[model samples]
Target: MENLDGNIDLKIKEISQKLKELRLSRGYTSYETFAFENELNRVQYWRIESGQNITLKTLIKVLEIHQISLGEFFKDL
Candidate 1:
């Protein structure tokens, strides 16, 4: 079986790419703007999107900022 770290790293990279695509689709061309609009600091948002440790609450907030439903967020890719 893949190691735990490896599995998490793969998942994080996958989710991070999707988040970035979603942001781009919304015309959030500026990272600072996206962060500010979402009420999250740059570093925290970076960590969350980049697949660093992210709280469930943070994920929920990010999804909400993009006006994406929780069900959609969790939908299979």
Candidate 2:
């Protein structure tokens, strides 16, 4: 169970890293700016990038904003 928990943590970190990378690729140095421009809840977006648990709906919304499918998003992770 401990190992499973560790794996979940690692995946969350990976997802957060990927989100940050995507934001960077879009030329937004500040997460706040990105969130504002996208009309997202800035604090929540920050939490997502900080490896906090996010809902599937939120994840899909972000992915849609980035024009990426789940397959592409998780491909390298």
Candidate 3:
């Protein structure tokens, strides 16, 4: 169970890192700017990038904003 928990945590971090990379690739140096431009809650977006818990709906919305499908997002992860 502990190992499973660790794996989950690692995956969360990976997702967070990928989100950050995507933001950077889009030329947004600040998460705040990205969030504001997208009309998302700044704090929530920050938490998502910080590896905090995120809902599937929110994740999907973000991916949509990035023009990336779930398959593409997870392909290299």
- By TM-score, the best candidate is 3
User: Residues 5-39, candidate 3, lDDT per residue (tens digit)?
Assistant: 99999999999999999999999999999999999
lDDT of 2 by residue, 1-77 (tens): 99999999999999999999999999999999999999999999999999999999999999999999999999999
Q: How many clashes does the backbone of model 2 have?
A: 0
lDDT of 1 at 59: 77
**Alpha-carbon shift of residue 2 in model 1 (angstroms):** 5.2
TM-score to true structure, per model: 0.81, 0.98, 0.99
Clashing pairs in 3: none
Candidate 2 Cα RMSD after full superposition onto the native fold (Å): 0.5
Report, for all candidates in order, the number of backbone clashes.
Answer: 0, 0, 0
Give the number of the best model, judged by lDDT: 3
Lowest summed lDDT window (length 10), candidate 1? 46-55
Q: Candidate 2: minimum summed lDDT over ten consecutive residues — where?
A: 13-22
Model 3 Cα shift for residue 23 (angstroms): 0.3
lDDT of each: 0.80, 0.98, 0.99
What lDDT does candidate 3 reach at residue 15?
99
Residue pairs with backbone overlap in model 1: none
Task: Order candidates by TM-score, high to low.
Answer: 3, 2, 1
Which residue pairs collide, candidate 2?
A: none
